[model samples]
Target chain A: MKGSLSDSTKRVMDIKNRKWLIAGGVVGLFLLASKLLQAVELTLPRVPLADGVDVAIEWATINLAPFFDGIKLVVIKLLVAITAFFDWVPWIVWVVAVGGAAFRWLGIRTAVFFLAGLLTIVSVGLWDHAMSTIALVSTSMVLILVTGIPIGIMASRNDRFESALRPVLDAMQTMPSFVYLIPVIFLLGSGKVPAVLATMIYATPPAIRLTNLALRQVSPEIKEAARSFGATPFQMLFKVELPLAVATIMAGVNQSLMMAISMVVIASLIGAGGLGNDVLFAMSRVRVGDGFEAGLAILVLAIVVDRSTQALGQRASKETRTE
Target chain B: MAQEGAPKLSVRGLWKVFGHESTGGIVPDEIANKSKEDMREDDGAVLALKDVSFDVNEGETFVVMGLSGSGKSTLVRTLVRLIEPSYGQIIVDGDDILQYSEKELVDFRRRKTSMVFQHFGLLPHRSVLENAAWGLEVQNIPKAKRLQIARETLDLVGLSGWEDYRPGALSGGMQQRVGLARAIAADADILLMDEPFSGLDPLIRRDMQGELIRLQEHLHKTLIFITHDLAEALKLGTHIAIMRDGVVIQIGTGEEILEAPADDYVAEFVQDVRRTTVVTVRTIMDQPDLKLRQSTTPAVAMREMGQAGVVSAFVCDEEDHYLGMVSFNGAAEAKQRGDATIADAITVDEYPTLPADTSVESALPVVLEHHNEGALAVTDEEGVLVGTLLPSSVVGAMAQEAQDATDHREASAASLEASHADDQEEADGDGDSEAVDPREGMEVS
Candidate 1:
């Protein structure tokens, strides 16, 4: 009597129509809510919390220093050691390593940037200093990864832990670079230790935040499936959850590396040695040419580290996708 | 072969509550303290599972059929202690598994059971072989032995050559097969499947269902399958448990459940069951008992039909092969017109003949489509007439069966209530005189 169609066809049509309406409503509601929220925020008067209660920045910086310093020292030492090993091997080894990394990450053109950048540093007689800087960033990244991942996992599992850590992460991400120096200068005192400490504090938030987010984003269905198969909590974490979140964690590492390099230059103001010190010294004497040279050297160092780490992250993702 | 002993798995009085306002968190108030109407309205504390109990007989396909959020998945999970029940006892082979510690639970999972999920849950980073071997490896089986077993299992599921491909490289159906292969390789006694074929295309789903049936026929492993598809339940389940909300509404054999549904919900579920696909010809066939006459001429054909007391006759050639049919009217018309040859006038391939092995269910469609007046002839492979099924007879048989089913349901419900009232009378200590069956009083229906 009705439209003599199959029941399944009708069901599918109904589902599609429902999905379309839902999508439209979601978008419209999101725009309207944002507009309303913005208006409310603009109309509301601003008020500051009690002066002593504003401990977000202070606590974040204080907690961040030791971790950052530990990272910087590890990076510098590793870089120096790697460079010394490379110096003994044939120049072709360097070519191959950079070439392989370049091809993997940003492709051939960026690989050229990588090669040219390295060559320029060598040509300018700043290879050793560049290696030390490279070492500092790598070491910082390693420490950050080791510490941040566990904290992230914990935060993801416990809602209270995550909520408690939120303000600290926010403050670490937003605090001025110069403000990081005030506390580290008082506790660790100006030098490589303070500078490393400062860089760690500046660079750790992204890693922690990303790790937490990645772990949280893992599909509940996947976890339930794993559990039903009799995976112990620990086994589930290592074998299922961590492996699934590998790509996001790698991206977090890339962010951390970028942050560390930016901090390295700022750390130079606290009397930490490297291209930062080189540029700072050049600037203090009104020597524009020397300062420009040192600045270029820092740029070269940043590009090499950024490309290599990014390439590593890309490789991890590619391997994951293939599986 | 049915084992004469206790079931392989048994659950008793399982309860899981969430968001309860309590400090110690040790006990839950009895559901009877609240009325059915109040329970439906109150959303404060969600009761995921409430006094759910069942026994999974060894080597039998016990299906838990329920819609999403009906606690079927939760029930399965709790049996394995994936989500701990607030109050319950699970006896696996007569051992109270609910008392098992963490390590003991791990040991139980490793040795006693394996699960297949709706989403397949194959490790995305591992090859098919590696993924299949994961469960064995977790139990510390030697890599070589595990891989060898994994290979055999994959071959069993028709994925022998794709062992090196990751789950991402395979289609959804193949991935599910791989998941199945993984569970089989674990060599667990009980296999728990939670809507394992729900995410596949209809054709693939049917194929997988057939594959599972074939596998079960060979292996005869204990299976507790959960699905929302009524058709799948009827096809695979030796016994089906229909659940609603957080409780099982009915548990019985497929035929029993279909013949006499427990309630309005189950009745509604089976309302659209296409009888054409479910009934068989054996249920409707009648034995042939009539005199036969050899007639080649139109006048002889009329005489034979008049003597047989039937509407139609199966025509045959000299070799005894089926030709078609000759109706009484046709024979009489030819005789009156002075047709000399009955063979020349008889209709060839005029009658629709179905095989004896075919279900009355499948034949209903063929009969309806062709608009046949009466029974279609049944034939053998050699095209010899075996029997005939009338359209009127099938319709009449089906209507009678439906009526009987309804009557049976009502009788069963009355008996169930009577037994429940006796139990309540025994439990009454203060002589309140209010009898109630805890199960009947449950809000599931």
Candidate 2:
């Protein structure tokens, strides 16, 4: 099985000499193939994948209307409650509360940044829209974590479930955020509820994936130690596993929040009232100044939430390590 | 648990086999003789424990010792059912714990025994006090009471001022102390320690061993301590069990083990134990009948010395306070000169002395180099003549150690044969055992 040193050396020498020739040949083959294809008049083929999706959507809309309606009822109630709560708060109160939270979690720099960003939103006359978007993002984030964590825990407990979830999460991540609206609209029809659904669908994968990862990454030594110490399965989960996994799970929540905030603009397509709707409306009318202000408001809101949540995650991780 | 007659813990016929249930009930004869890995391949079972049986007495430190992959860790962990054994009966305080129900097992663990992990199983997120209080927390003790107990336990482990510090922030030895504190804070009757000091530097490990010995005196919790280090085992163990390939090769007191190793595996491990440092002069000291009184005549002393062989003799006072050495030639000269007593003719400066408790291993060298005058006299605290140590006796002691080892090997071989017979009988009876008994099989069918 052994190759003599000289033979191995000669093979290496041969490969080095022919490498450039091989590169040329490969390029030549690619060019020749393209030329032949060109002579054959390269054309795109039509596929019925979209039509199939449409038919499925149509069928589901008719047959699953009551099921979708039940979901819609729950979704609408939660969305309205969240939005109404934010709308009831005064603009100055919103600015102060957010600024204070940012200060507490992310330190002074982001607090200043948050206040500046909110004040700019008010100065640009998009205060109400920013509030509405914050409501949407916060509600979606809460929903994401609530649903994602349990599924993540289940996946952590079973290898098969985790494997099954990996591909679906990948697809959710790679599929365009706007494409989520197609199903959302078909099921709930254009409104804030549909937008929330779309935002949740787009943003939820990272939360689930990361939570699963956090639980799986827990050291078996620590796990065994917990069990041997007489912790019940439930106690082990709540006491040892969750505490150890908190920092990683917090990172997941931070990512979910960022994903939710980024989807706010796209959420406007289905008539969700937010900075996204303002930007959409401004763009439709070609009002550059209005578009710029609305876009700037979204950007500021994303940065403020993103920075604060990230800092919270970092703080938790550091505390865990130090303890 | 407070009973007087029952041992603190007793494990019998314990076996832990890791893998699928396909080979759970049957083990082949060749597989039994094979190494752990080969046996695993043969039957798809990692035999982590095999016929491990040992008794740990109440308030005693029973150390289980073996090198890595020697199944010592498995043996200790299986006692607590951390890594559950495939078969065994763990009796603690006259209760067969293997038959404990789910709730009963939980209660048994919470109430009966606690463990100190090799890696120092302090919760990473908990402070030193919290880690110590973890057992009580799981027991659902009230917060204030648990914290109070934790604070006291930390103090007991010599971590009084550092109670508020995180375990992660402590040194390795201190972290293990925290681990130890957790076990003690539980107030369990027994503590199972799995190489709790293996991660420490040598000095720190040694310090921890000293601390453990001191703690054991006050706590008196029946501790099943596991370690691969022979010195640690010897220093701390009241009784030690040496294990190899899941079987306990021998179990005896520290001195018994030093004097008699059960097999080559134990002999090889104990070879580097520095017996000289541990074995004392008291063990090898011989009481010869040739003690010469200071009042005895020089001519009589010469007669006694010449009778013994030819050499100097130890001449002590009537109360046995070692005074001086009396040589045969000096006694003969005194006899020729008509000296009345050996006291005047004694050679006090010639013989060197050694304390009774000096290690025979170290004392032998001193005796070999300087015993030209006579046998080295060993004295007690009051400078009284305890006995004499000779070069021959010191060499004889080593020879005795070798001979004891041979005797132990024979005993162990016999015990192994007997245990194998018992195991074969058990396997035959337990072979492919189903949930339903054969008598009940008719009903099931």
Best-fitting candidate, measured by DockQ?
2
What lDDT does each candidate get? Answer: 0.73, 0.80
Error of 1 at A60 (Å): 17
Model 1 chain B worst lDDT run, 10 consecutive residues: B436-445
Docking class of 2: acceptable
| Cα-lDDT of candidate 1 | 0.73
In candidate 1, which residue ranges exceed 4 Å CA deviation?
A1-96, A103-106, A321-323, B1-4, B20-29, B35-43, B275-445
lDDT of 2 by residue, A41-123 (tens): 65789898999999999999899999989988987788789889989989898789889998877778878988998899899
lDDT for position A249 in model 1: 85
Over B281-370, each residue of candidate 1 has an lDDT whose tens digit, in order, gives 544666443322234777776676677777767677666566676777877787788877666555656566677656445565677765
Give per-residue lDDT, candidate 2, residue B377.
Answer: 86
lDDT string, candidate 2, B287-373, tens digits: 855888999998788778788885877888999999878778888888888878988887766577788867656676677787665
Assess every candidate by TM-score: 0.69, 0.77
lDDT of 2 at B58: 88
Q: After superposition, how far is residue A121 of candidate 2 from its true place, in Å?
A: 0.3
Model 1 residue A16 CA deviation in Å? 41
